[model samples]
Target: MTEGTSNDSTSDHLSNNGRSCCNKESTNSNILDAVQTSIDSLANKEWSNVESRVLVVYTGGTIGMVRNNRGALEPKPRDLERRLRGYPHMHDEDLAKEKYPNSPFLVLPLYKEKHCIIYMIHEYSPLLDSSNMTCDNWATIAKDIRSVYKMFDGFVVLQGTDTLAYTASALSFMLENLGKPVVITGSQIPIFETRSDGRDNFVGSIIMAG
Candidate 1:
C-alpha cells in the first residue's frame, strides 16, 4: 500500500511538469514587440538596419489631419509611429485612443517609403492643403531641403497631390546631390478615407527604397 502511494505521487508530479512546459510553449509574443521586430527586419538593422537612411520631409498634407467634433479638418502633429496609425501622440481621448491601438496611416495620396532617412520636415502653417499652398512655400521648402541635404541618404516629400508635380519640379532645381533618391507624392482624397488611393502607392514607395 505504501509503495502504491509513492507511485501515484510520482505520476502527479510528472503530469504537473508536463502542464508547465505546455503553458510556456503556448505563450504568445507581444503584438507591439512583434510589429517592432517586423519593422526592424524589414529595415535590416541598418540603423534599425545596416547601410542607408531614408528621410520623410512631412511638409504638410492631408496625411496628418483629423476631423473636429464639428467635422472640420485640422492638423494633428505627430511622429512617424503615430502617423502610421493616423493619430496624435499621447492623446487621451477615448475615441481617439480607441481608433489607434493599431496602425494610423491615412489613405493619403503620397506615402511611399524609399531607402533612406525618414525625415519629416513640417510646414509651420497649420493647414497643408494644396489649394492653400504657394510659391514662397515651395521655395522655402526647397531651401530647407538643401540645407539638410547632407544629413540624409535620400528624401521623400509629403505634399498635396494636386501640387506634387509643381513641388517635385521645383525641388529638382533646388537639389545638387546627383546622389540618392528624392521622391514626391500626394493624394486627392484623404488617405484615411474610404475612397483613398494611398495604401498601395505609399507601400510601393517604401518597397522602392529597399
Candidate 2:
C-alpha cells in the first residue's frame, strides 16, 4: 500500500511539473506576442513630424585618414565627406536631392519611427592629429558650437582616438550652459581602410547627436 501511495505521489508530482512547464512556456509565448504587437504597431505608425538636425564638427582624426604616397595614413581634406557620401548607410543622397536640394547638409535614411536626421559636416581647415590637439583647439571647437548652438539640435565631434578623453574633458569645462547633446567619437583604424571601425563609430555618434 505504501509503495502504491508512493507511486501515486510520483505521478501527481510529474503531472504538476508538466503543467508548470506548460504554464511557463505559455507565459513566455504571451510575452513574446505582446512584444511583437508593440513592434508592429510602432512600425506602422506615422513619424512624419519627427525630424532632427545635427552639426558634425570634423576635427581631423584617424577616422578620416587616408593612405599617402608612402603608404602612411594621413589626414586628407574633403576625403571624409566624399567617403561618407559613397556610404549608402551614412548618406541618403536621394532624400537630400528630393527635399533638401539647396541645403548643405546630408540626410540620413529614415530609421526607428521613420524620423529623419539631417546633418552638416563642418570640416576643419587644417585637420590635426589628436596628439597635437591643445586647449586652444578645444576652445575653438567650443566657440564653434556656441556660434551655431541655436542652429542644431545636437553636435558630434570627430577626432583622433589619441587624447580623445582629454578633449572631451576640456570641452565639458569650456562649453557652459550647454543644453544640447554633444557626442565625441573616433576610430583606431582609418576609415579609408576596408576593415575599419569608423563606420559604426561615426553612425552611432551621428544617431546620438541627433
Provide the global lDDT of candidate 2 against the true structure.
0.69
Models 1 onward score TM values of 0.52, 0.73
| Candidate 2 C-alpha error for residue 176, in Å | 3.4
lDDT by residue (tens digit), candidate 2, 1-210: 001122223333323333333223211123233323322332222222337877788889889898999999888897787778887888999987766655556778878967789776778877878898765677667656655555567889999988999987766655534556889999999766889899888888888878
Model 1, position 63: C-alpha lDDT score:
56
Alpha-carbon deviation at 91 in model 2, angstroms:
0.3
Question: Residue 92 CA error for candidate 2 (Å)?
Answer: 0.8
> Worst ten-residue run, lDDT, model 2?
1-10
> Which number leads on lDDT?
2
Runs of candidate 1 exceeding 4 Å displacement:
1-49, 79-81, 85-127
Question: How many clashing pairs does model 2 include?
Answer: 0
lDDT (10s digit) by residue, model 1, range 99-175? 32232212222223422223223334344677676655655554444444444455566677777777766555444
